[model samples]
Target chain A: MEDNQKKYTELANRIYDLDGAVYECVGSSLGRTFTGGRERTVRTLSMLMYTKPDGHLLRSELALISNMARTIKNKEEKSRMMTEYNEILMEIEKLPDVFGKVDILDDERVRLNLAAKREKLSENDHLVICISRTQGSAGNDIGFELADNLKINYYDVEIFDQVMKRLEADKDAVNDAENFVDFNKYTKKSGGSLKTRFREFNRYHGLPKQDAVFFNMSDLICNLAKTEDCIIMGRCADMILKNNHIPHISLFISAPFSVRVEHIMAVRNMNLKQAVRFLKKMDRQHRKYYQFYTGEKWGKPENYDLCINSANYGIKETIDVIRRMIGK
Target chain B: MEDNQKKYTELANRIYDLDGAVYECVGSSLGRTFTGGRERTVRTLSMLMYTKPDGHLLRSELALISNMARTIKNKEEKSRMMTEYNEILMEIEKLPDVFGKVDILDDERVRLNLAAKREKLSENDHLVICISRTQGSAGNDIGFELADNLKINYYDVEIFDQVMKRLEADKDAVNDAENFVDFNKYTKKSGGSLKTRFREFNRYHGLPKQDAVFFNMSDLICNLAKTEDCIIMGRCADMILKNNHIPHISLFISAPFSVRVEHIMAVRNMNLKQAVRFLKKMDRQHRKYYQFYTGEKWGKPENYDLCINSANYGIKETIDVIRRMIGK
Candidate 1:
């Protein structure tokens, strides 16, 4: 719990630092222009990070503004601009204090409801949690915390890695299968001549290497479920468990794109552009991978017993909810 | 389509006007306190609307700031504040244009992809679309637009309104049934002394008036489904149709909480606090209503054929996807 609090504080400080940089840029820009408001400042910053092709403010753009400002040769105007700049700097200095207050507000909003103590359970008790999360929603962190709290084994990408290793499989095989499946889908959609299409379909997915990997992975997951209580993350574990008639709580965690972009930017120390690109790519890959294997939509609520927004309800609070659910 | 464009333009203008007011207030406030920056301006505006109990900025707060400004007696300091005030007002004057740019960005974001011309279908073509949406997700608008585009009838609140009128029912009875069901849920959760709880449950519901109303509403919806191709919205219509084994597409539409709040605030002409309150209440009411009838979690993906985010993909693109699905 103390570690959790420390992590949050660290995150809060990171946000403060980023917001500080943005606040300074906005203040300086406004000081120079004397023609834009707070909304314009935020919009510019957001656009630079979220919508700009490069996903960040171009230094060239800043330099261009500076060049324009330098061209204003009137001595009086230049002196006035300096005064405005000084005033803006003074305001920028106070931003940390304002952000401190905002941090407190966010803390209040995210306070986790700790679970009550539960009765002792026998070793044979059946409990499995399959948690799937969108990229940048901190699914891994939540999975770890929930597992630690529940005193259960946690499996994530490492499990998939170990299984692939055991099978002596190449990862690219999965990509090939995914690509083949995707091509099949497009061809099916386009509708070619019947005989040609039937031949193509038969040749397309004849138990490809990726399907072998998934089959092996599902068997591994089912074997794990039968052995002990555990929290499994991703790799279509939920669908596999469901097919095996394993009664378990399936959970999907997601956040808004904006929130996720912010999270990835902060956590990964990536600029806005990189973060957006990374998250979008990951989401698409996960969706395609899940859909290809299960023939079901990824992150669809019906596939999961619980669908939650970790960004809306804080991760700790979400875990708390899950704890209560497990108890029931 | 032209009317839709007009409405969006009007909404953008409304946002511009509101932002103008906020800009003025922020400008004047900043002029008084040279220690504040863009972050402070936005935080203050957000707090005034979203956190304040009255859901708006109080006149008294503005007056107090004025009074404090009047008390500052230093000539240089006073003159400096006035200069800052003038500069801020100058910036405020340029806000409409800034907002115009943002509006265009938003417009680009929400642009709908109109569907390709679809083939004509027979009257008994077995096409029913049941759409359930989060409050303020513009579900009703989407439903109406989808129905119009498909040249099918749309049923929403009016259907429930008609059903209630025919049954000579009041809305509170519905609320009571929801409450009774919620209580029964608690009793079940508690696993109370079985005999007493069973008797209490039997005596409590006993074919309540609200259930009668629901029965009629369900009948009305099912009859409508039998008649023609149509889109049904809300009042657990999706669940009702599903129970009746109606062949249809069930869709669930959702948006991020902040997006939904903004939608309600703008469209309902409510302050941020009021909008948030109203949406939360409506969501709770809906969850209870749906759970009471279906004994299923509202907004679960399994209950629907397609789950979408209007905020993510825009309403028009969502409609386009639905159209393609229906055609297939």
Candidate 2:
């Protein structure tokens, strides 16, 4: 265990150094826009390192970091660093699972806390708005302002932290849920044919670890929607609530690809090329993430109730349009 | 020549018969939505037959008609029709081009008409708005209203007629223009590098017959923009004006796929499934057409100055937003 901990610590520290070096090299030349790439990877890896240190995530991160490192001008040094990271990855694959089985249902404390919170909430007549948006479409800004106008709690990254906490406390919960299929419950809720219900069950069972996080995150979103009138941004919340038969106004905010690239360039002080690359990468990630869990095309108009082009109306008018939509 | 005329007339009549029968069968059952399908195909084929009996277009139309006919309930009848069409297609492939070459440059009448029209117009400080929209987004309605409010000429299908008239008068004009590659003229106009200019020249040279029609349509749009203020709908007019350095505001109108589907169902009296299928088909066609002509992604925000989700703000509010955008 001590040896594993040392190996993990050394790998984490190296990732930190490489991240800083890449940032210092590229960020200085390209301004601040390039910081999000390697820097974000390191940040995410660090969070995982501190929490779970899942082998699959670490391997993927190492691969990404090595790819980014190859872009550096010093080819010889980067190649050497990549070789070292590959060796570390191989070693990580051999390491035994550090986390033991967690009995989620037997945890009285978590259940009690959830029950107490549920008891205090009104749980009825609560308005929920799920806004899915493209990168740099000012979706977050619109969501925040809309939340303010309606005097409601806005959940964005906060929901991620909540899900993460739950996951840390009950690592086996998701695995158990995947193993346990409630066909009757699903069929009753979906009103789908037995074949479709079976397909849905298989989809739930086959979810990857990362996508399972989305599953848990979706549960948290459903809970939050029930507790209060709040605005949820991204995370396939719209589909989640709809599947749960919750009444909510779902909005998809997008702008032209060029408009989004320009918006990112302006906000992040990125050059045009950098902005375009960043937006493309982020858009692909968002699309894949949304599609993996929902089994629907991302940004397709039919999925959402209202689709708004933020560039058409800007921030203020966009909010006004939504306000009018919900009659708030 | 008389033999070719008889063959073309016979083929056209067969297409009309097949189209009517298909419509009479499908339209009666599916309501009005499916009427636009094979019926529109027949109408386009009839127009082409009357104006320019281009063998390439005739072959494609036969292929389309035969494919549509295959969908008919009477498989044996449809297969017989398909076999007959295939034989006609073979005959079309062998027919010599009957149309005489037209001298586009020495046409004094056309030049004089265009010159007279140009003279009648203000020719300066006119607002030209080009709108590109997805199907069922009420883009045509918005363009008409915007034109009405601004009191500008709205050109939609009218532009197609104008282009067709010019093409019929001078069949060789497009071919001549494609062959006459003035490198200096292109370089000076584009201010692109020699390599890019050579590539652009190749793109122009390699345009298919159908896309070459777009090239002529673009020329007409440019001429109209210079002569007077007008709102041009579709036909990649936005890129056309931008290429000519003609100042114009381009807008792309779209709605959520579901919203647009519902709109079509309501207006066309189509069922839910039929509306969804129609919108998807139209969207794919528009995207392909736009990309072929302009080499730009259709309905991309950056391509247009504004992209309005008309569902957010119905027809009236959408027009009002555009009015505000242009400060009209």
Candidate 3:
């Protein structure tokens, strides 16, 4: 039911249009020249200046602001923006930054680098490919096709040893997160030890590990985001590729169940139907993995740069379509 | 990849065809046939006479007898036929001899008194039905459709529990016959065991239970071949259904793997292409399972009464064609 990549590109263009609107909002807010903190002086006179196509703050949204601020070409204005954020913190009734030690400017700069890495701005960022497969579906074949075309690395996810290593590192975190009773009661981002562990586990174990040879692949991905673009297969890559400016494209490829069944029978040598039932389970696992980590619902248009149906477009055409869109 | 019921009928009609072709051989054999060890003599002779289309014993083979017999139609001249089996031994042999010396004819005559069962038969010694399926080709749907059309019992094979009990009781015999070795070989067929105990733990823990349910379902379907004229879905039904004179019309329904994929995707709500891989594994399991149980290669035209490609013949027309064939 997803629109093709051509449609997806049109949608992406609209999203970029929204970005222009957001920039305009910021301009309108700054034009007011209201910049103090006392009496809860606004960071921007009105958020109405920025039209959030989707309203509500995102998880870890200060990162987005930092990314946007980093793109500001003027060095003085970038530093000034950070100072303005610090001033907003002081104006809020909550508390005063007595020492001015938060260093919001440096934090934004760090976020800028992360966005750069996520976008693969330089040459060294290797593609991180993720894949979600059904029992009878020729997932490996498709992943191979895309990787061959893209000339990037590829891997199947069944190697449990590497997955476990990723799992072990985060076990304590996930257990802690689950065990944590009070989430949101502290400002230090405490609790969610289990969630953290699981997320890390999914990032590695859930991922095909060839790209994971890098230590701390997630961080590396964030770092790599600034270095170069990635062509990741399913494994929640859209979620991993979260930055608006990361220059990475997200894709979800699928075919009709019957077509999958026939292909399984012919190419994969499956029985008449074992794959049909399996597809349901895999779909659940895939969507949960994506939604759980990325906090972006899987298969949603907003989550992917392109969601393709190979049934409609055929495999080769689907990949080509994706290439064209990613190029854009 | 297969022809229709005409091939089966052609194979059946061959008995008549060869009956005429071998007239000279029959006359010569009968003329010189010796009285001593006549049962052995006839047994040896009959093996050389009737060769089915693909050179295996016919599924319709009731007795391993030559197209030409040594008997004369006239009772007075029948004394000459005494060179072969005695009448008493012949009568006993022709009856169900597997159990040894039971009043087989009288037993059948007695069972005929069961009104609910025998009432439907019109001078018919036996009733048989055949339904064939392809990998992910909606054979279950077709099986159910045929049953509904005929107003007969339709078994989905998945929910039937008695199959497991039969498998348990019948496991040793099956193992002996085919060198069968299931990986989960030791789980108790009759009752509770460690595996079952662990399963109970899962129920207590509220784990979704479909996995266990399906495994047991396949076990139940293993023994469903005892009844005649029933449509069974992919659980070694074709293998178990083998019997001579029962007209067990083996059919293989095929469709392009892509078509099967679509049917599954639309019916099951799968994403575009995810089901392709899974359909492959399931088909292999069914084929292996069939070969393991019956020692007959699955999907061989010789193994089937009729094999139709559903893609070539649409579902409705396919069903109609099968029905017409059965009506004859």
Candidate 4:
């Protein structure tokens, strides 16, 4: 990937160098105002008269000169400037090459072609899109919206429902296992005294049932992949598809902690303490679940084709960006 | 998480309702300009005189009235406008309240306080920072920069070196094992027919030696964590620390694929194809390695305290943002 960028960068740099030389020939550097007074004015006037004023430059120079001419109070000075401009114009009329330097246009075209080639080479495989997101990042919302816009099937609880329907797995048992594992971690971190009763229940129950449910869910995910192009949220879908050699675009959506907490606080009507605790607990469970089943970090950027911050970009813009990325 | 966000949305709606009423008292709707003509002007003038103008409102109103006066065509009309403005000014002078509405300021203060509170709540376990990054996201660069800025001890391959020096493990064999695991998956996905020779070599040689190396490295990581606050890069340090109940901030850094590819291409002096291939292989190995031992997603955002895009924000800004986030 790095090597690819280098070639493009090298091409870009070369284009800039060639273009810069051409720019110097016609006067004025790219991205800078024409500041060299009389010399710049003369060169610009000559270029305008000689070259087919590539619309942008022509419009700018015409505006500048007309504005500058308007500011001149002395008719004699204005007439002198007009004479210089006309002299340059007459000389330009005699020139063979109408475009001051053709190299810049050629260079720009080459640069664009190189960029296009690089883009083409980096296009992604798009059989499926597996979206794994943090709890409060609005990953599910983005997934549903993306699936709707892309007109692909979306599977969130449907994946769990499908597995449950097919395998007769107890949903409550799975939830208990997931909650227990996360709760156990939190309790262990917090010294376990406050959650003794829950700990006692979890200690006897364990996560074996959850493990069975997860394994079956993995198979169900693979089966779904074999059948359709869909947007699957969570459930370690990205990992499952990758392991099975299924082509997919994996997406991870996240937001900064403060934004997420605020989101929770507003949505749950919880105080700061409650919102913080809820966010931490939910995130812990998600991490544990992904780690347990896929042995991969749930929110790792590399695991996904796109990593978006819903809070940073907002849902609509993020979705639009994703659509453009997917070429949909 | 969705439940939590819903409550916050409810509270925000309530705040808007309350604020809207207060805004109506002030004779203008929030976030909208008064588009009504003479009646609006009279009401605004009356409000400016009768009610106290908050500094923000005073500034805005002064600017708006000054701009409005500039548009008067006739000298007599302008004089009349000035007289009316002077009357309002005189009335404002007699009034005791300089600012009628204080809700906006109070609202702003509440927002700041809420933000501060959230920041305080998210203050992390800072015993160690285990940074997991993508192959060409400049994760190591950011890690080194972060460690230097925070004045913490930094570890990248120092852990591997420490483990290797202690165990005398065959480094080449370990590399071969890592390469093999990554290559194995790729070939498996590609149908395994063409790369059979490489697979045969990897299958027999296996990763036992590397596994030994990894185990020793995990012990080294824990021992180091027991001693000091340091930033450790890669080698699934985040996972090991988490399981051991060591308090740490795990960070995942990544960039878009094209950006990473360009980085690798330039840094490694490889062509686009070579860079792309290299990145894929390296990433696969990193993922496999992290999952193999830690059983966690290598780049999952949930696994980290913060996840940044070096390409999106740029490395310097990303580092600064992380530093601010960590309060270092």
User: How does each model score on TM-score?
Assistant: 0.33, 0.42, 0.26, 0.36
Model 1's chain A TM-score stands at: 0.52
Deviation of model 3 at B82, angstroms = 49
Best by lDDT: 2
With candidate 2 superimposed using the best TM-score fit, by how many Å does residue B124's alpha carbon deviate from the native? 9.1
Which runs of model 1 end up more than 4 angstroms from their true locations?
A1-328, B1-125, B163-206
TM-score of 1: 0.33
Stretches of candidate 3 off by over 4 Å are A1-328, B1-126, B130-132, B162-229, B243-247
On residues A205-313, what C-alpha lDDT tens digit does candidate 2 reach at each position?
Answer: 7753345556677778888777777778887887887778665667778876766776666555578999999888778767766776688878765455456666655
> Candidate 2 DockQ category?
incorrect
Model 2 chain A lowest lDDT segment of ten: A98-107
Quote the TM-score that chain A achieves in each candidate: 0.52, 0.51, 0.42, 0.54
User: Worst ten-residue run, lDDT, model 2 chain B?
Assistant: B98-107
As a whole number from 0 to 100, the lDDT of residue A87 in candidate 2 is: 64
lDDT of 3 by residue, A80-109 (tens): 664554343333212221111111111222
Docking class of 3: incorrect
For every model in order, what is the number of clashing pairs? 4, 5, 72, 32
Using TM-score as the measure, name the better of candidate 2 and candidate 4: 2
